[model samples]
Target: MLNPPIPLNEMDRLLSLSDLDLDYAAHQDSFKDLTKLAAKVAGTEMSLVNLIDSYTQWTISTHNLELEQMPREDSVCQYVLMGDGSFEVEDLSADERFKDKFYVTGGPELRYYYGIPLNVNEHNIGALCVVDKTKAKELNPEKIELLKIIAGEIVNRLKYIKVIEELKSNLSEAKQTQKKVAHDIRGPLSGIIGLAQLISAQGEDNQMDEILEFMSLIHKSGRSILDLADEILSADNKKDKKTPELKGNEFNLLVFKDKLDKLYTPQALNKQIKFTVNTSLASETIPFSKNKLLQIAGNLISNAIKFTPVGGHVIVDLNLITIDEVQHVLQMRVTDSGVGLDEKGIATILGGTASSTNGTGGENGYGFGLVLVKHLIDSLKGTLNITSIPGAGATFEVNLPQ
Candidate 1:
């Protein structure tokens, strides 16, 4: 069998090097401890922790290259620039892998080199490369294993930096978005509410009907403002909840069916949509968070009210399915008659992406509602399932352990 040649372009890309990467590439720029660690592992006097950018290599940890960054073309660790498993040159001057690679042999009497790529993702920033002045030494399995482990430690630190970068970006965006949405909605909402109050105080007349219409508009606008505020607040308070104390538990969906009815009543009234809350499960409750149950129900019902066309219907139901002869699961569904979604929309909501779409009254949000739904289900150690056709409404099923 012939071997397939790796594309040179893709092969050279190594560890994750974000604009926020803190790794200094110069051997002189690295801390003394790291330089010492590198030197010790390579049994060399010039071990270096190198990070390569497009034009130059930075020395992060090094024993010999103190205070000076080598050029990209002259970097022996440039081989580490590849995200491939690892690069080792037993004798930099003799090995075919890098013998003609002038950077490895031309500088510092370097006769040997070995490097491990520090890839955090597709971003290949650089390598933990080592060099020596003596004859190439054979490294056994144990020695190679230890080198890889040290490389992992370096990568772990890099990953923490990367995550902090991502979180900061997400946080900033969340706050700004909440601010703009809140500001835009608040002015009109307050005006409508104030005017409604003034009309209610007017002297009574056949104007009662006109006043009532104003009152209804005010109420709907007020609800919209409230919902917007809730969403904004929720984003700002992204839950940093300590892991909940987990224990054996159960939630009763059958008995909870009636409670679901009470909750969906307002939604039905507002949308003019008929909703049925029914149960088929023998065991209404499953082992899960009692409070999370309410949150799930509230979100689903609220969403139905927002999307279901006027005069359409929504049904909430639960059923028991035997997983095995001895085990059963409580299944609950919230089905609504409304604008149906395409396959991509379903995937976004179901595949852990926040998909937003405009609601019945031109209320805009991600078409994806199942993000929260899926998260809540996971928190309860349960499962979520969804099915929808483009024209038919969506059905969401929450399966809980009994």
Candidate 2:
């Protein structure tokens, strides 16, 4: 028997199939009645809903015969996937392509066959086929039309399954984002609580200026926390596909640097990595999204520290250049002396694929932060440049409009 020709878009078809994660057996009930109707309409003894994957032809649902899953090379359904419409053999034993010694010659002595490709999202993934032991002169036109309609229904069911799968995947990603948001808020919240504790401990013994300074810091940090909630953690943003508004507020560079120092200094120390920050800005307060900057800086520095080996150095440089009266370009560079990424690792990060890698100091991290950083940069209409040499060091430079 002749083998089936492979489709030109085989790689893409397989990728689409993998994303569906189709298990026809698990969803057999959905197609059982349809398969039965298809067999009865086409006057065949057996009918099947078969999916051809990279390695196997899986009969997800069957009528009047046992469910058979065989290697793709051995299954006739593979031929249907290569075409856009139905395929037929009036007598299997009469056709060279299908006149095999197994089913066609001895087992069930299958004679007649008809099948239509099951197309999903423009890719022919499988087939809806009917087989009979008796030979037929020709296929009935009316029956073929009815079978095509049934195949369409089957395709609809597959589309529904795909939608459900996508929703589930999106829900999972949302949960992960929620966890990261909570983790992000924890740092500023802890600083707030610590400031409160200090004010309580000093009581009336502290001077008015000292108390006012503590209160001012608390207010700035509190505003930053609120901004995180309103922007990053908003429920409305999730429902809509548009980018979240990166609103500009009067942001203090000194405060931003202080916050980063408070959050990452101890983390660096714990890992025995030296951390340093240098700033050269036109003004202490500028028009920009403080929360977005914090996210961009926090994710970069944390990743730098995580990947930096013991005794290595992580440095962040903040430089702002005034362009016009209303616009300023803030350039932030994060450099790390760590185990840098190879080409594959860089490609994976740039592709926005979530992956986990063990750090140089043995810290474990899912690369979600890098993905978030990319998103924020894109939302701000900014640019990011990366340069790295594996086993030596890496640098991440971001230029954002303020």
> What Cα-based lDDT does every candidate model obtain?
0.61, 0.74
For residues 274-352, what per-residue lDDT tens digits would candidate 2 score against the true structure?
Answer: 9998877555455354536755676688788878889999999887778887688888899999999888877776665
lDDT of 1 by residue, 1-402 (tens): 111122244212321242333423212332456656766765766666666543345666666654345434445666665546777777777765456544554555568777887665655567777777776767677777777777777777666655665676567566668667886787777787777767765624546877677687777778688678768756545641432222222245544665566545754774577888886545444333333565566557667656778888888877777787657766678888878777787677667685555567544343323455666677667887778876678887888765
Candidate 2 — which residues are off by over 4 angstroms?
1-30, 53-55, 81-83, 94-96, 120-123, 137-140, 204-402
Using TM-score as the measure, which candidate wins?
Answer: 2
**Candidate 2 lDDT:** 0.74
Per-prediction TM-score: 0.36, 0.44
TM-score of candidate 2 relative to the true fold: 0.44
In model 1, the runs with Cα more than 4 Å from the true position are 1-37, 40-46, 53-55, 60-68, 79-112, 119-125, 132-140, 153-163, 196-402
